[model samples]
Target: MLILGIETSCDETAAAVVADGRTILSEVTLSQDLHNLYGGVVPELASREHTRTLVPVVREAISEAEISYDDLEGIAVTNGPGLVGALLVGLSFAKALSYSLNKPLVGINHLEAHIFSVLLERPELVPPFLCLIISGGHSNLYLVESLGRYRSIGSTRDDAAGEAFDKVAKLLGLGYPGGPAIDEVAKSGNRDFIKFPKARMKSGGYDFSFSGLKTAVAIYVSKLNEKELQKRRADIAASFQEAVVGALLDNTIAAAEEHRMARIAVCGGVASNSRLRERLKASSETQGLLVFYPSLELCTDNAAMVAAAGNFRLENFPPDDLELDAFPYLELGD
Candidate 1:
């Protein structure tokens, strides 16, 4: 079946065509350059960009796929767990298309889409696995028993890992989307330059906390002199990156062992960090667990992941109506 997926959960306006959940015919993403200068996403600006780019992006995706509206079996859209205004634009557009085409409509959860990104990359991938999702807005671990069936195993109590990276980068005058920037700079520096705290919750649950680590970095940088700061840029970046990656790996490995699961996967924007990927692969090997990750392009927000997730929902859940609305704070299990 041909499925049309629309995603505007964040700054990127994206659309894609996927066949039977596995084959991505075309995926088009219109990134917001306007947000780059601001060092972070502006909600109002992101919403406006989505409204302006949605139609063109969708058209391009369909055209590139060489498929007509009549060929699509259903329409899927990200309805929530994102900026409210930004999500509304994509939701409204998707609803209109579904209504006009008289087709089935599926409301997809943004976080769930991140997990499904793995399936898009590895068609043979199945459930009964553990997922560690670290992104700009969220850091979570899930026990994915099957498609659309997830149980939260761990999550952040404060700032997300990606958010921490961006905040640290902004402090150091690095550009937006700080993961790549910090990763590049950290390569030449010592990962052990300065010991950054790896926050461990006393409750001992599978939850995470990055806000403390972020604050620690801020304080460390504030105490440095101008010359020291300039000279230790790489060292600071490497040390900070190490702390974040260590926390993630520690928690995920613990979750896997606790749950006695042998398969693990990492998804979301922060999962794109080269260091995190390397560490996860190494840890998975040591633990005798299989590790999975989406293609680097699919790690961030994109319609391809949305389409794959929607296709999974269509196969597992009951049909939806056009009345489905966008939800800014939707939870995965809810």
Candidate 2:
């Protein structure tokens, strides 16, 4: 099926065309640089930006695919777990488009879309595998048995892994989008510079907690003078990155082992972290497990992933009856 995907759950306004979930016909994403000035997203600005760019973005994707609206078999969109206004922009556009085009409408869960991001590249990836979804708004561990079937085995207790990265980056005076900033700065520094805490669940479960680790970073940076902070900035980035990566790798590896699964896929914005990609690859290799991650573009919010996920949903689940609405707090597999 040829699916037109729209994604505006966050600051980015994206649209794409995918064929049968595995083939990307065409895709376009316009990122809102406006958010950078505020060091975080402004929901109002995000929705306004989406409203403005939604038409052009989707038009460009269809034009790039060399297909008119008549060629599309279905329309897919992200409708949940994001700012209500931002999500509404895309959902409204998608629903209207679907109705006018007489195409099937599929509503996608944002987090579930992240998990399916890898499927676009690795079509062979199927059920009976573990997936670690680490992003700005989410840090979850799931046992993906099949399309639309998710068993959440582990998740965050407080701030997500990417959220901690952003918070720590702010503390270090790193600009917006902390994951990339920390990844770049930590390259030349020592990962063992500070023995930052990597919390392990006392119950021996897969659940995670980054609040303490974030507080520790805050307290450590607070003690440093201006000159000291400038001198150790790279070290701080490296050490903090190490702590976060450690917790992620340990939990994922443990989960894979406990589940007796040899294949794993890590997706979402945080999966783009150099440290995370490197460590997960290295650890998976050492433990004789296969790990998959989407490319940098797909790791961030994109309509391609949404379309890719929606293709599966369209095949498995029935299309919505137009009564569907944007759900700002939708859970995966809901």
> Taking the candidates one at a time, how many backbone clashes does each contain?
0, 0
TM-score of each: 0.98, 0.97
* lDDT tens digits, residue span 1-334, model 1: 6899999998999999999988999999888979879999999999998988888999999999999999999888999899999999999999989999998899999999998889888866788999988999999999998777899978899998999999999987789989899999999999999999999899997899989989999999999988988999999999999999999999999999999999888999898899988888888888898988898889889999889889988887876786888888888862
lDDT of 2 by residue, 1-334 (tens): 8999999998899999999999999989999999888888889999999999999999999999999999888999999989999999899889988999899999999988888789899878878899999988889999998777889889999998888988999999998899999999999888899999888788878998999999999999999998999999999999999999999988889889899999999998999898888888788778999988888889999999999888988988899878889999788752
For model 2, give the 10-residue run with minimal summed lDDT: 325-334
193: Cα error in model 1, Å: 0.4
Can you list the residue pairs that collide in candidate 1? none
